[model samples]
Target: MDLLRKSIERVTPLTNEEWKLIVEKSKRIQLKKGEFLQTQHSFVVYECFVLTGSFKTYIMGENGTETVIFFTFGNEWICDLNAFYHKKQASYNIRALEDSELVVVTKPAKDVLFSKIPKLVNFHIHMIEKANIVLQQRVLDLMNKTSKERYVDFIEKNSGRLQKVNNKNLSSYLGISQEFLSKIKREGEVYNEKAR
Candidate 1:
């Protein structure tokens, strides 16, 4: 509930009544590591606010390789927004990286909320815009950044995630081979030693 209050504050402080309504409408769920929040091809009926832990949203290619597109920690929103908006099947799989607690608002419930609280519209737009910018940066990095550079960037952007997640998942997300990631790590160590 404290996390929910924080989340509301982030979106533009909710009124006491609004907060009460949100609490009434929303449900908190616990997710285990590797648990799916939304599966690929399933309709995303709810948008989740992460209360604790981290998650990765990924897409599986035809060749069966999984490419991670986004990461979210506590206080972040994680959902297939377009799918939820359009009431269509989700394109990505959102999985919890560790045990997590999430506040979930269903699409119908959100619609009711927006009608009651107009400020939510602005919050939704802001979230969408932020996600778009992140996607644009990710695309540019994929095109222009080398594997080593991407690895470094990943480490920089997701320092906590790098510590918690396995190297294999990190390698896949960075679009590099496990061997290549290992080599980059070794090279990084050497570079640090030389700098020292």
Candidate 2:
């Protein structure tokens, strides 16, 4: 619960009463690896805070290929923003990449929170703003960055994720082939040797 408090504190500091109210509204959830947090077309009734573990939020193309859009790890919030905000079905699916624990707040509970705790509204805004910034950066990278450059950035941003996730999944997220990712990694080694 301290962690939850810290997560919220990143955006806004809550009063003791407000903190208690928020905590009372959240429920803990546990999921095994490969479990679906929210499937495509499902309504996102809750906002999830990752307590321990990682998740991938992705969309399947018409051809049945998964295109990952975001990764959520411990201390991060994960939800289909469109579904949660608009009260519509989700277009993306959120799946656990490992056995995970999450704290979830239902939409109505969150609404009550905002009404009762004004600072919480600021917290919500900050959350959405952070997600939007990340999404915009991803779009800019896809449009302007080279595959190798993007791969390098990905590795730097998610330093340990490559060790946890399969290469195929990483390749899909980078919009490159597994073989090409391998090649980029090898190229990095060669560049490192030259610099040394």
TM-score of each: 0.93, 0.94
- RMSD values for the candidates in order, in angstroms, are 1.5, 1.3
Please, what are the lDDT tens digits per residue for candidate 1 over residues 1-31? 7876876688688889988888888899999
- Please count the clashing residue pairs in each candidate, in the order shown: 0, 0
The alpha-carbon lDDT assigned to residue 31 of candidate 1 equals: 94
Looking at model 2, residue 35 earns an lDDT score of: 95
Ten contiguous residues minimizing lDDT sum, candidate 2: 160-169
List the pairs of residues colliding in candidate 1.
none
Question: Whole-model Cα lDDT per candidate?
Answer: 0.86, 0.87
* Model 2 alpha-carbon miss at residue 37, Å: 0.1
> What C-alpha lDDT, on a 0 to 100 scale, does residue 165 get in candidate 1?
71
